[model samples]
Target: MTLRGERQADFAYQAVYRYMINLINEVSTDTRVKLPSLRQLSQRLNVSISTIQYAYSLLEKEGRVYSVAKSGYYAWPLSGSPSTLPSGDLLERLYVAARRPGMVVLSADEPALLASLDATLLRLERELVRQHPRHLQSWSQPCGVWELRAALAARYTSSPSRCWHADDVYIGADLRGVLDILIEVLGLRGSTVIVESPCDWLILRLLQDAGVRIIELPWAPDGRLDLPALEGTLIEETVQLVLLSSAVSLPSGVAMQPFERLEVARLLEQYGCWLLENDTYSELGFQPQQAALRDLVNPDRLVVFSCFEKILGPEAPYGYLLSRHMSGELQRQFLLRSFRLSSIRQRAIARLYHSGQIDQHLNTLRQLLREQAGEMSQRLDHHLGDQVTYRMPSGGATFWLGSVHAVDMRQVFQHLLARQVVVAPGELFSLGGLHSQHVRLSHTFHGQPNLEIALAALGEALRQAQLG
Candidate 1:
């Protein structure tokens, strides 16, 4: 089926699902409610019977409803009111508060290396503009600067499985923009996607905004991918895409082993699922580069989305999407809606990458991050020892912390916010509201003296909540 047709069909199923949920909610909780029949609902809702069936099947999988042979689907009795998922409203508030002047933002996800690279990037940007004045005379090519695309494509060409070319690379303003284009061009709306539990908040927000259903695959306590759970989910759910950081998972900061990547690749191939590999944090791994999942998954089934923001700093916010199978139509749709990135910045980054300066910068950045991670872990142990639990990050910038005792992280967030400290409550990470007692803290601001004060305050707030 065409992408647009699949999207429309999924939308129909979602409409029917929501309608059923509303209907089920209206009935008494003490008794079971027989749902409208597929034929009846199809006629009533002006949708095909197959759409209704698809909706019912999803509801059955979710345990919202059940079916008996020769009988219509029926709503299961409610145990209590359905729990509300964390809204973007709270996330927005936290983000805004985090950026307030003088606020101690332990919730930051951006790398601290950005500040150190300003002078170098500025110099490079100026040099590019001076040497390439003609770039200003014309609009950037629809696919972005050819040099940039070529440079990016060259990185993946070494993998025999991924014979990527410049045409296969599409650059956008940033990672989020690239993702938005992918969602639109791929017609991911109303489709189901599997994401890591405690996934990137931006990713979760974008998926939710696109009207996509998200299934979160949580990490095992030992910080490994729960392969069995992932396999079970793939078996049970009609998941269209799986989005994850194959090298280093966010929030948790756990790097996947080669075997784990191989297993995930195997499952994705077996289930015929598209993989959106977020390689944004791959360079931050403490150990040597692990095997790439791209080498394991079919090239056509994998789309790599990465950006220069973490490495080159937010000043050069450019992201590229790499896939061996980008169709002409998909490229056309992307060009029509996507913003053109700065030609000067693209050239500058391309120069940086080709000059091998990026590798040198990465080596320095990785060491800084490692030191910061250790410092953050030590501080956490000092202030909140035994009060909160967290896995010391293997890579990436943040720590996923769980309160040892029952405590509402949202409440902690609000409490800390009043004191000019901002924290990302774990509720923002999942659709199921499963991480209410957890919070994601970043080591980005480890060098700041106020970070220690913020951790102390956080420790106090968590202790109070535990006592209450």
Candidate 2:
């Protein structure tokens, strides 16, 4: 039997709704049993609350469930034999498989230049000896080591807008910590912040856990900023800041157009909202660089942030925040929170930047990533054929793929995980419903041969899933 209002076409919300139906059938052995709350179900299923509500509405229309005004949905178990929900063990097993050491992991955020990291670290070691003993002994000033800041300043001065200065740079050992501090420093608590749906999952999770009031704007499938919607939202809500990834977005690797960035800045200025531009993957672009919002927007209204993890390695993860509107009190607050900085590490990074090695490394890294992305895309196309579709990432390490047919991504993720192949479920990237059949694959972790093997394995898994 088919579900009412169900269509055969692929859509994220429909997929989630169908899954909810199956879940009710699989569970609901007793009548009037309360279903999980929308928030609870959303978190458990990695879907959005709106998706759950839509599914519930459909179920209510079909008389499969009933809702209490202030309570929640409840299943109406029919007499005689009854069906039960799928075992919760499904997701448990999937996460466990993802953790296996030898799994064909495609969700890794590791750098593509894996082999060259050792060489870079060795160079850092060599450069570290040149720093004065006194500099190493004392605590780094809150603004960070002067040499590193100066190096960062030099790099930014090369851009179209030569506004960055040594004093404008602030270093943080942990990117997330720095961001949290920035949010507080900006006095944005209890204020509405706008973020893109399907943004960096880690960042999304961080914001959620921090209890920030967020308004997530759904990104169009084509990867452009929904400006009209954004402006509408700004008009309707009081937004303190807009967190944007202007270079390459996570999962999708889609870049914002140059004009779009400028327009977004203009809108933010008009609405009196600050723009925190995250350009972490900007250096990975394969073509000529596009203009950044930092160059287009008034410096007082825009603060740019990026980390070394993409260019350097995970072991050396430090980030720099550049802002022109920072006040003495704000700087002091930031410094007060971070009493000590890693002087040695800062000096090493400074050497890499000052000696031009950073640029040379980036030139090579970008080419390597481009080749890896190409290999992954070609392999998927050759093996999966029409079963899957994906766009070749222009920058960043991940490719967001959508299934060509109706398939439960959760089941597919499980099947692939059982075979020790790991991919990120699309639902994990958004706060609400998404293209549920979508999955994310990372190309930075493996070389061509291993990538080919993983793709072949994934193709087999897809075939199996389709058959079932």
Candidate 3:
């Protein structure tokens, strides 16, 4: 009668499946409950994905688990329980993405980097408060504290042609917010916007919500955004903006080459479109770093954005958008049209960074991150060569992997999940929400044996799927 031992020893997977089903009834407060991720439950039971897959299939057949399209499996969506739990599907996804003991975290590209604030910098922050007590008295004005923008403009522009005055810069909630304002002020509604394919999904989602028409440019293997594919679509609409992430490129950590950047500038000028360079990942890469877009581009058509949120963790709230693209009237319209940037949060985070606290920590963090990336790429190639192929990146925290098979990544995803490994499926990063046989994993989760186990489980899953 025990769920542990198979009542019918011939079916080892059946026991696990039934046990999961019964366990759901016992542990779940409501008759309708959510399911644990295949990965999390897989690790806890020391079981392979075959068992979990079989169990999940059986549960789905029996009406115990509900699958939601574009999301994941959940306990019956109508969980009758009065208690509100974080949606099981979301919790399971988070549990898999978050670093846990003996769990694989491949979904994000965060660095395995860390350091503490230096005493001097900490003292500077305190002194800023003591010396300028009145500065903090009011919510920082919309334009931002004048001194920080001056500092930010200096940091943002390295080329003489790109240098900006403090008044031209605006500190906003984040890149999405910045883009929204830029579009509104520029009267960009219904205008065509060009974006790189396999792009940052959140940004694409924003454009979609705004009813902005999107034209996707295919990316070449070297990570160059395909200028030719864009040319075909550019003529159809009044293409006003071309958005790009040139350094530490997301989803694929491929930075654009320097010469290509110069060409990008020239192309935009010819096309008579404005350029918005999103360099959020600029500082988080391995290479020496490329020149900022504005530094090399015609300033009248270029607006550059860079931020600390990605490089220093999302907790670091400060970032700046350098603008020389707007005219006197547009600048006034930008300022007058919208409430000032998220002024207070931007100033505080910038103050910590400006005080030299962030710089000191970054030096040590870079070294650790580089070493960890080496370890991750090595293991990925070793375990999943035939089924997966990846190129060790030259200098970014993330790398790309693809399978030649026509298989949906969801199988690999479920397989990894049973092993507690979570990676962002490539389909989610693709244009049109199309699923692909690829995924992106970050090396920042290195230095842990769980990562190793997860990779091995992935191999087994790939093999099993291939055979079937």
Q: Write the per-residue lDDT of candidate 1 for residues 307-336, one digit (tens) a residue.
A: 877776645656778877756865786567
Model 3 deviation from the true structure expressed as Cα RMSD, one decimal place: 14.1
Which model scores highest in TM-score? 1
Could you say which candidate leads in lDDT? 1
Candidate 2 lDDT over 1-468, as tens digits, reads: 232235211123456567778777888774447788977876666554444555665565455676553356767654411122223433223333444445676765655444345467656755564544532345537667899988887776655555678888887755765676677777776778898777776676667656778788876777787999999999999898898885776667777888788888789889888888887888887777887666766667877788877778743556678877665855776666643444666777788887888888888888888887787677777977778877677787778887887677776776666556778877777766665778888877554456666777777666766634
Candidate 1 or 2, higher lDDT?
1
Model 3 weakest lDDT span, ten residues long: 77-86
Whole-model lDDT for model 3 versus the true structure?
A: 0.61
The pairs that clash in candidate 1 are: none
Better of 1 and 3 by lDDT: 1
Question: Model 2, 128: alpha-carbon shift in Å?
Answer: 2.7
Output candidate 1 Cα RMSD.
Answer: 14.2
Give the per-residue lDDT digits (tens) of candidate 3, residues 1-468: 343343322133456776777776666544444567766666666554434544665565454664443354566433332232234443244332343333456676545233333343345545555665533445334445666677677676665655777877776534555666666666667778888767876677667767788877756666676766666666666788988875656666677788778888777777788887777766666768767665666678777766555555543334457776564644564455333332333445567657775666666677767777777767887887777866566555676777756665666776666666777777766566543766777777535767777778877876666523
Candidate 1 wrong stretches, greater than 4 Å: 1-88, 114-116, 135-137
